[model samples]
Target chain A: MSTETKQKKMITDVFVEGARKGWNLGVNNIIPNVLMAFVIIHVLNITGLLALLGKLFAPIMAVFGLPGEAATVLMGSWLSMGGGVGVAVSLFNEGLLNGTHLAILAPAIYLMGSQIQYAGRLLGTADVNSRHYGILFAISILNALIAMLIMRIFV
Target chain B: MQEERKVGLVSYLALIFAIIFFSGLFAKAAGWLGVFDFTVLNGSFGKILGEGGKAFEFRGSGGSGAKDGFLFALTLVPTVMFALGVVNVVEYLGALEAARQLLTPLLRPILGIPGSAGLALIAALQSTDAGAGMTKLLYENGEIDDNERSVFAAFQFSAGGTITNFFSSGAALFTLANADGSLAVTTPMLIPLAVMFIMKVFGANVMRFYLKATSKR
Candidate 1:
């Protein structure tokens, strides 16, 4: 076989293998969870559950310059990013949020969303103490706080 | 006789984190998702949301409302699943390892970590758990040092799963824009990401400084 033929074969094989694996993982792992989040969030919004929660968080949320209802999305984010997005979509549909609102909330949610299950375990594997886990958590929030400020002044 | 192991500070904090995480789910049960009522409103609150004879109703027909929003988010399902599928393929093909060198120009000068940490960063852009798992594996294999591990972990926690967040949720900006003629999604997201990246680099360095000061190793 010619060298050109061998190179072509290798490239084709890798992409084919990679694509097959990617499809399987996405279908199995991502689809069901995303679907569940969408349904649950729709139910929550339709039932006015999120609005009720937004009221309770109104004061604290106000401090961040977001609508009271934004607390719902922020809280959802702490659980999972999917939950956050679901709530945000529902809120946007309800006309409760704007682009600026989502802009601020997006970075904040991204910063702190996965602290519970992922960071502690990751740090633990590196022999990082739990105290530092909390510190990093605080830092993530701090980053969000700063992000919010940037959004206000520049974005 | 059974030996006793005392509950430590870490466990206590972990419990707190768990409480906050789960509580976020039922924020509505606590009446937190909506300030007054997420349901149909009355009077002025209703006036603001309803606006122009358009009521905020679930499955509300027409007028760039809730039903459309739900469907718009649904549109993302295909984009997200396909993007992640590509991510899976890239990772499967060992693209991360190959791309490690390529990312060095940004990683080393900007983030202050070795170029190899790029693999963990790439793994993290899809899933936080996967990123952490890869970092743990790398640490276990002695591929990175103690300080480097801390730096990587800090970066992982901040902007972790960023691309996934952007495609799936950050695009909420797009829907919000299309609905109300507001902000664009991509550019705004890129700035936040840049900010987050700088913050992560700052965090990594801080941890590095702390480790050096404490001399724990």
Candidate 2:
């Protein structure tokens, strides 16, 4: 084969290999999230815990123009964006909610997932007490609350 | 660093490309197939908890159909694990040391975060939850001081998880634009800005309070 053709083939091979590895990691991260979501859903269903929690948080959720039901989605969003979006889409369909409402409500949905915690874990492999773990929880939770408040004003 | 552990630049670049491709392909494919349709599966738990137990509900669709459930799970899982593994491998290869050395002076003074902390921050910005896992690793490393960790946390909390913006928001933006059948740039611009605005407000406070607390400690 010509040098140019060989080089092209090599590049393609490298790209494919990288993609394979990337997919492997993506699948690993997703498993827990999917499994957790399944477990959480099942637990909520059997125990009626989600409903009780929703009622408890309903007043606070109303502040952000979300129903008491939205707490689950918001919580899901905190751990993984997909879970949150999944919940959001479900809520919209269930309530027949309009786009504008979903738009205004989407900010909080986007928040959470607590990235700082993830950072801590990566860095933690080097040593213990990255300290960012707890801080991330605080930052993510507070951010969601504050963002929700401001977004609500416009809604 | 051990020679056996060293990863070349090509390895890093290859990993990045692969990640972008798989994430884009799988996430979109899963969405398209309606793997997360929610009709087949039910609530997270069988019952409710907390106040107003009956009021809260977790929604699920799409059953444990081998194809859809497996596909959806695969799409989401790999994003986090691959990013984490790549990051670990890269760091293990001491790639960050060279980069960190170059940025120490600037990062130390301005961001007040250790050079090692920057990698996690950048990674988290790409994907939030995965970043959290990364951050936890960093925390366990003792490479980051308390002050730096707090600052790092704040930065990530504020700005991380843009992956969602790129795919979810990007898709929505396109759909909205298509519905209008216009070449307008309004939706494209607004969504990013809104996401950014939310990040900034929280990011600033997270850093501010963290700095203050560290000073007191």
| Most lDDT-accurate candidate | 1
Name the runs in model 1 displaced over 4 angstroms. A1-56, A124-127, B1-72, B81-112, B126-130, B141-143, B172-188, B212-217
Supply DockQ values for each candidate.
Answer: 0.17, 0.17
**How would the docking of model 2 be graded?**
incorrect
- Residue-wise lDDT of candidate 2 within A1-155, one digit each (tens)? 33344345443454345446555534554344444555555566468876787789789778777777678877777666656655444344333233444554456555565343444443343232445556656666666677666655544
Residue A39 Cα positional deviation in candidate 1, in Å, after optimal superposition: 6.4
Residue B8 C-alpha lDDT in model 1:
44
lDDT of 2 by residue, B148-207 (tens): 555655655553555444333322322221112232122222343355445644564567
Real contacts recovered, all predictions: 0.28, 0.17
